[model samples]
Target: MTLTKTFNHVDYLWDDAHATSLGDDQVALFLYRSNILGADLRITNYGGGNTSCKTIEKDPLTGEEVEVMWVKGSGGDIGTLKRSGIAGLYTGRLRALKSVYGGLEDEDRMVGLFQHCIYDLDSKAPSIDTPLHGLLPFKHIDHLHPDALIAVAAAKDSEQVTKDIWGDTMGWVPWQRPGFDLGLQLERCLAENPGIRGIVLGSHGLFTWGDTSYESYINSLEVIEMASEYIEKRVAEQGDKVFGGEKVKSLSPEARKNQAAKLMPLLRGLTSSHARQVGTFQDTDKVLQFINSYDLQRLAPMGTSCPDHFLRTKIQPLVLELDPQEDLSDREVILAKLEGAFAKYREGYHQYYEKHKRANSPAERDPNPVIILYPGVGLFSFAKNKQTSRVASEFYINAINVMRGAEAITEYTSLPRQEAFDIEYWLLEEAKLQRQPKEQPLSRKVALVTGAGGGIGKAIADKLVAEGAVVVLSDINKASLEEAHATYGRDQSTYAVCDVTDMASIEGALDAAALAFGGVDIVVHSAGLAISKPLEDHTEKDWDILQNVLVKGQFQLAQASVETMRKQGTGGDFISIASKNGLVSGPNNVAYGTAKAAQQHMARLLAAELGKDHIRVNTVNPDGVIIGSKIWEGAWAEGRAKAYGITVDELPAHYAKRNLLNEIIRPEDIADGVFACVGVLTKTTGNIINVDGGMATAFVR
Candidate 1:
């Protein structure tokens, strides 16, 4: 009820009004209304719902006016939708072709049918709900799984409750898997009830249609608002009451994150053999409130709040027993307990599938829990990417909110297990999950980059992501880390505030990376200091700063990453960013040069020792890499310029001219060299690759 109408994006839809075409107006309205609906998580989630508008288009070949339906394409998010996201299909042709598909059909054949019906020939794959939109006689159609309405729709007395609430203003349909038959049945229901504003499918979602996009969107909003109001009144009538008595106590956020820190990796490792991303909701306010509630243990395992959530988050969450007072430091003990719980959950899922799966159903999916509920800690969601994991977490939170409202009014109910299994394992939904593009070279490879806030480190992180790697960016400055995360795509990359000088901080960062992405396959040690001074003038503190970050910190980072790689039985790469000065020292550069030299030497030693474990170790040395960099903007800039016999502004030119190539090396240059060492030169390990614009003194023989 609190969600207000804020559909002020029509101006954007008409930005290029002078060049607008015949059907452009319809596309604009559809996109605008779709964004408005998608903006509210209560109305729709990540990509759960779909929207469409029917219009007339001219066929290029035949020069004939054709009725077309522009439906939201598969795997498209309406919130950030574009013109290309909506598929234009010949509506009349599709409806006529329905007669061609007569008997039982597998989902794969239906995919071919939908693909062949595209009016625009070049449009993306049409959504599976295309038939639903095509059969309806409305100019515009909207289908959404609004959480509030879903709670009412999932009730055992759904028909009765809906009748009591809206009388005959709404139409009720029984649960039916989305297909041609359901589409036909929906059209028939509309034919039977001439003036109903919307249809509520039991345990599914809401469907509304109108002559215009505005009317359809308004109808959807109004119906959802009505459902929300009904739930509020029922909660009031039930009185403020706690259903179950509280026994388990709540822990502070810090304590809970610490607990999650230890548990997330074990859960990730146990979920699958391949790399996977794991996330926790214990820190989320909604999840914390729900987990600490008295009725959490009782309500969690009953069923999902909505049937459609079965695709994103399974039918029910796997609840784990956690003790706040018990020690969790022993990795072996905690790991064993987690493995036991995972085994039980897997066994249960298999049993459920065995009982419900038909003879011709798709092969049993990987028996892994998507959502895990920890009693005292928080909820954890797992997926292959960060966005999907985040979306799953959001749906579960919405589920909790809906269930809280439903249980307050009446006992919360859900579809039977067999029904849920049918929808979850349906070939149509399976096709949706199987429509991924070709995999990239570094797909699912987890990479950890230190000093990832700017310059060479940031460039390296960006490169890794572009090459299809899940990057964990860590920087000492929290602000820089957050900024980098935003720039590199927040959902694809995660940032960690880590102080490399501290062993505990290094270990925590490694743990966070393993928790965020299953395990580390690549480590880039780029955190270092440039404390330049003569050996006689350098203070103990100055020397310690250089050695701590460059030498000691690098050693700790490698140790932790190697341990994780060894445990995963996956060979990895450890690349340290050394400098040209390490090979040829300048005046008053004793500490900086010595530290860089130590880092390179450490890589060699690690290469020799870790080669037996199939881990490659290498170093990239680059100089004059100051473009778009903060390296030469601090107090050291003046000193470094004076050492090179030039002003701060002239230093870059001075160094650029000194090199044989006479080219100013950029951070990207260093990144490209690192990529070559790791990706191109697989057999060339324990070597120094210099990227200093071909400086003769800095060259390695």
Candidate 2:
């Protein structure tokens, strides 16, 4: 979690031979490779990585030597990279080769390759993965699919993971296909972050760079190593057995590679009947157990992970008996299980087609298991022509680990069969739709309610909840916040023990709220205390405290909330708990009335400036509110007792009678009005509705 500069490390190996072509670009090339191998940030994990650099020059045949690039060839360990580690290629030629979609002969492609690479042959063959790196516009680029970084990225809360690790500094991209798609996607990312120095790819890896090679390299290492340490802590917590193991048995990479070839197509055939099934997990024990399951093997009808995973792992595993009698050849068991699995898998596929696929593209392939046998050990995922399978294989591994863990816990509680189908196949809520919820009217909305410890702000929060807005409540009273969110309620709120006078504390509250809620959208400035001191005897500090709660506190909250809301694009709403003092400066309340007046205009100015962003700033100035609110019970009782030299009981009717309505407004009623301004009124901003008993009716229309 603690990521910073200043760490010792092994130096990157850079051979000079690969850099011989560029008389001037030599430093750029060296920096590109050195940064990759030296930093934890660039490589991601120990070796899951990527690399690129800009090329300049034209071929000598045309007497042109403008620019050409040499990227790290695929499958080469970047850590040991030297100047010779790079693979040279002509920029224009490589760009053109990417678009070639012909059954071009090997000899012709070889000739094209030689012509495409404008370099001394000493640089060696270009890396297979260079196409993507070469496609980017930057002078230098690198990628790393690291183990520690991916551990968190692969989890369900990868977004939060990145936030926790990188603070608000790193860019986040959700899981997506790599290669051409990733390159294009990141180009736009770089555009958004014009001088972006690093990228934390969700469910993938991190990328780091600088104007200078050393800067990029150091930053990347600092970031990755920091994240790696964090992940190590997490894996230790989850139990390291879940992360890595030296003794645990695994299918040899070669055996896995071979079995996946046979299994991929077979499983794909079975699960493809409906477009949702993916193949099984890779752990042999779980695969065997699942195959050996009395119920699953007997009745497997549909598929898993997601549809794309279906392409990754195939549809079904091969199936057969572990102990067959007379015909007992190892090969026979494999064949028989495979055959049995295919036939039933086909039947299941057809049934799925009947149930789900009424009219899609005509079913393109037959249903069958790619690999099946007694105690069925599933082959890992792979594609036939593609270099490798990534996501599905990860899925299989994670699933197997989870399944093995769960075997001790009785049963896994996935969604019921019908629910899974609904989620996977629903027309309106499938992957794309579900990935991004339709942005709501208050999509980028947030609110901060002061005095939320008791009544009005709490009521406002209740209403904001209905409108899908998150609220942060602040108060001078810490105990009140705790009591409000007691042991048995829906604890969906955050509280700040803020003293309005202190800038540091107020700023802290605002920052905490933003951090907790992602950002601030609407601020219900409700944290104020009431007092009624006759002007002659009013002391400066007494006046200051009241002003601090009612006026200064609001200013601080708005300042913090506005900054965040602006960045979030939600615009923002600032509503203050202004009394009727601004409209009718009441008796004996000199400091309170003056502060209230300032509070009203503060909102007006904020609204005028922020209105350009569609952020409507507003206020709800209320009077004579009763009920459980702290303002009514505590401050109102004490203030009224001092005002008239009378007890609390007489003050309720005394104040209520002065109003035209002759009825006291409940805290809930005032809360309702405030909520309406924030949630319901899309057009009205900078307006105040009075709630007195018509006491100040001179200007009342």
lDDT, each prediction: 0.78, 0.54
Candidate 2 regions off by >4 Å?
A: 1-425, 428-445, 466-468, 487-491, 634-647, 696-701
lDDT by residue for model 1 over 1-701, one digit each (tens)?
Answer: 12235332111222223323334588788887788778878888888788999889898879999998999988888877788888999888778766777644543466578876788876868876778888888888899988777877777678887787789998888877677767777888899988998888877788998787767877777788778878777766755353343456667877777767666666766765444444544457657666767788777777784655867888888888767655766767877787788889889989998999998789887788889877667788887666777788888887886776667556677778887888888777777778877766666567899999887889998888887777889989888888889986656788788888888888888778756665677899987667655568789898888999999989999998887776555577999999998999689898888899999999999999999888999999988776765566575677788777788888779878989989998888888887887777878779999998888877678
User: Residue-wise lDDT of candidate 2 within 364-396, one digit each (tens)?
Assistant: 244543333333334333222111223345444
Model 2 clash count equals: 45
Clashes of each: 0, 45
Residue 412 C-alpha lDDT in model 2: 24
Model 1 score (lDDT): 0.78
